[model samples]
Target: MHTKASVQSVADTARGIVLATVEIAARPEHVFRALTEPDQVVRWWGSDEAYRMTNWEMDIGVGGHWRSEGRNADGTSFRASGKLRRVDRPTALSMSWMSDWDGGQASVVHYALEGTTRTTRLTLCHEELVDRPDACRAYAEGWRLVLGWLQQYLAPQSTEAFFLLRLNPPRPNFSEDMSSEEVALMKLHFGYWATLLQAGTAIAYGPVADPGGTWGVAIVRAAEMDAAWVLTDQDPVIRSGRGFRYEIFAMPQLMRGE
Candidate 1:
């Protein structure tokens, strides 16, 4: 995971041009789909509390049209439309972008993808902002944030996980064998998961009954693996000094309504 590339490099070249580059651990075809596919665009193009991209519509061909709709943190709406000038699948794309906020000025945006079987190098060039130096600086920062979101969206780790819990002794009738203090601790554990479940962060959690022993499992949603660890660390079973531990497994594609 440490070897995967993500952070972007930005540069101000000519008077009107801002160039940025980022490496993604995905095939060119996969990255290209995220670039052109409407559903994928809405997922990776922005963040929930920042610039949220709620809608995307595009026609995939040279001379076709594209549009995006989103909102800022302040509840203000924004929109951008473009006509595709070039479309090279798995390689490059270019378009003319006209946004409502930019005095309706059309800017040329180009993306060049260089990739091997496992990774891709994506370069973006936004031109025609030479006269709008303020816009040029803003774009440099904006593109940096955009590309960072893309990289995180494409990361291989699952945002949801299963936490398997067990007692150190592994007894079949442990529930019946538990002391009064242990029962209180178990209640705390149940309450903790209940809170998360009501908050929609915890999906489901319960005990697994085996003939020889009983173990517990919890399914949860977390934005990152480290975040998942934070939840598990806070589990009452873990913090109560009861010799309880949880083994976590990532569920990259979780089935809903199961």
Candidate 2:
């Protein structure tokens, strides 16, 4: 299950860059259709609690124009439009994005897809908002939620399994006193798992208080153990080049009750 992730992309709020990535159990061609095709875009573009994209217009080409208009949950109206900057069917698309809710200015939105018929990795990058940090932060959550909508629309039959992640720090008292760099890395690690938790990739994760020593533990869901390894490998602690390690185990049987 430890095959590499489709894309190695993360969001940088300071840079006004937001990234939302997901691996769908479908071909890129099919996902691309759902993304660019006008008829299908209306099917999965928004949320029921918020605003649903009720109208869509698309000119499918580089330098083409696309627009979407919808009403907010409170019945207020909103609209967004963009000019296509690049188009690579089933692979990528880039455009100049501007929406009423997005600072009413031109930013950039790029979508990259990589995969086969079994599973496809999709990544969305919303960039060029250096002047609007709030928008950047909001888009971080918005894009992830939007991706969740797209995944549900695809109706995938993922090979999901429960994984137990035993996180080991360098020393016994590492948690009590971490270095400055370690603290910063912990922030990134928290954000990483927080994103996953919101996206439904993680069930629960936090520091563990052990009698002998304190460590960390994360229970996540992935297609397989290799994929679980991929998830752990991306953690800030594991990638910090420090001596942080994770022992992964599979939960063969997970019983849930009310």
Runs in model 1 with CA error above 4 Å? 3-6, 9-14, 156-258
Tens digit per residue, CA lDDT, model 2, 130-210: 867778888777787777767755542346778788888899999889989899999999999999999999989999999
What pairs collide in candidate 2? 1-226, 1-227, 2-226
RMSD of each: 15.5, 20.0
All candidates' lDDT scores? Answer: 0.76, 0.80
Instruction: Report the Cα lDDT for candidate 1.
Output: 0.76
| lDDT for position 4 in model 1 | 50
What is candidate 2's local distance difference test score? Answer: 0.80
Score every model by TM-score: 0.61, 0.57
Over 76-122, each residue of candidate 1 has an lDDT whose tens digit, in order, gives 99999999999999799999989987877989999999998667789
Looking at model 2, residue 32 earns an lDDT score of 79
Residue 136 CA displacement from its true place in model 2, Å: 0.1
Candidate 1 — worst ten consecutive residues by lDDT sum? Answer: 161-170
- Tell how far residue 95 is off in model 2, in angstroms: 0.7
Error of 1 at 194 (Å): 35
